[model samples]
Target: MKKINLYITLKQGVLDPQGKAVQESLHTLGYTAVKQARVGKYMELIVEDDANVEQQIEEMCTKLLANPVIEDYTYIVEEGIVQ
Candidate 1:
């Protein structure tokens, strides 16, 4: 098996309201040192190993996992053993 870890984040110059809100909230909670924060998505998938796993995951990310217009995605594939 293969474990696919995907991370999706907004591209630079895109406004991240959720991250801003979290930062502000942290400041209110006395974490004034918090300067900047950006929120992103992480997803994990377990799939049967294949010769084209990388290509398949890339296509999945582009087609559904991330928005190409404002977000970018990267992934890592690791070998996983299933007993």
Candidate 2:
């Protein structure tokens, strides 16, 4: 089996309203030292062992896991026995 960790975030030059809101909330709560805050999505996927796992993951990301217009995605694959 393999474990895939996917992280999705807004692309550069894209406005992140959620992040801005969190930063403002933090400032209001006295965390003024924070310059900025960015929000992202993290996902874990388990798949059957296959030589083409990486390719499959890339296809999945492009097709459904992330928005190509405004978001960027990266993933790490860990191969080991499934627990």
Candidate 3:
């Protein structure tokens, strides 16, 4: 088995309204040190270990998990980790 930890985030110039809202709220609550905030998605998947798994996962990310036009992603694969 294998473990996939994927992180998805907006492109550098993309607007992040959710993150902006969170930052504004934080500042209201006296957390004024934050200069900027960005929201992102994190996903974990466990799949059968195989030679094609990484490619399959990349396909999934591009097709459904992330928006290629505005988002970028990275993943880490772990071996022998089922716990």
Candidate 4:
């Protein structure tokens, strides 16, 4: 068996209005000095095999997991032993 970890983040040049809103709200709530913030996505998947997993995960990210036009995604695949 195998496990996949996916991380998706906004592209460098993309603006994150949601993150900014959260930061502003935090400041108003007395948690100042928060600086800047960005939102991202994390996902995990359990699969049966490791072969070509990276390619497959990348394709999944491109096709459905992430918005390639505004975000970037990366993943790691690891072997899982099922006893």
Candidate 5:
């Protein structure tokens, strides 16, 4: 089995209103040191180890897991991480 960790985030130049809101709230709470804040999605997936697994994962990200035009996604596949 393989353990997959997926991270999804907004593409550069895209508006991140949620992140901006967090930053503004932090600043209000006197967290002046924070220059920016980003909110992202993290997903953990367990899949059978097979030759087509990598391709399947790529398709999953591009087709459904993330928005290809506005959001970018990256994933890490680890061996022996799932039981």
Candidate 6:
């Protein structure tokens, strides 16, 4: 078995309105000192078989996991021993 971890984040110069909104709300709630904020997604996948999983996962990310125009993604794959 293998474990794949993916991290998706906004590219530089891209505005994260949602993150900004949350930061403002936090300040209003007395959570000041927040210099900046950004939102992103983290995902983990378990590939139980070795059937071109890496290639397929890369393709999936390019197609839908991330937006090439405003976001970037990176992944890590590790071998695991399933019980």
**Of the candidates shown, which would achieve the greatest lDDT relative to the real structure?**
3
Query: How many pairs of residues in model 5 come into backbone collision?
Result: 0
What TM-score would you give candidate 4 relative to the actual structure? 0.87
lDDT of each residue in 23-83, candidate 4, tens digit only: 9999999889899889899998888775677788878888999999999988877786473
**Each model's lDDT:** 0.93, 0.94, 0.95, 0.87, 0.92, 0.88
Candidate 6, residues 1-83, lDDT tens digits: the string is 88889999999889999899989999999889997889999998887868798898889899999988999999998787483
What TM-score should be assigned to candidate 2?
Answer: 0.95
Backbone clashes in model 2: 0
Q: Which stretches of candidate 6 lie over 4 Å from their true place?
A: 49-52, 81-83
Candidate 5: segments with Cα more than 4 A from true spot? none
Model 2 per-residue lDDT tens digits across residues 1-83: 88999999999889999999999999999999999999999999989999999999989999999999999999999989566
* lDDT string, candidate 5, 9-75, tens digits: 9999999999999999999999999999989899999988888888998999988999999999988
Ordering by lDDT: 3, 2, 1, 5, 6, 4
Determine which window of 10 residues in candidate 1 has minimal summed lDDT: 74-83
Q: Tell how far residue 16 is off in model 6, in angstroms.
A: 0.6
**Between which residue pairs do clashes occur in model 3?**
none
Which sections of candidate 2 miss by over 4 Å? none
Mark the 10 consecutive residues where model 4 has the least summed lDDT: 74-83
Evaluation by lDDT, superior candidate among 2 and 3? 3
Q: What is the lDDT of residue 21 in candidate 6?
A: 98
Q: After superposition, how far is residue 82 of candidate 2 from its true place, in Å?
A: 1.6
Compute each candidate's TM-score over C-alphas. 0.95, 0.95, 0.95, 0.87, 0.93, 0.83
Estimate the lDDT of model 3: 0.95
Which stretches of candidate 4 lie above 4 Å from their native place? 81-83
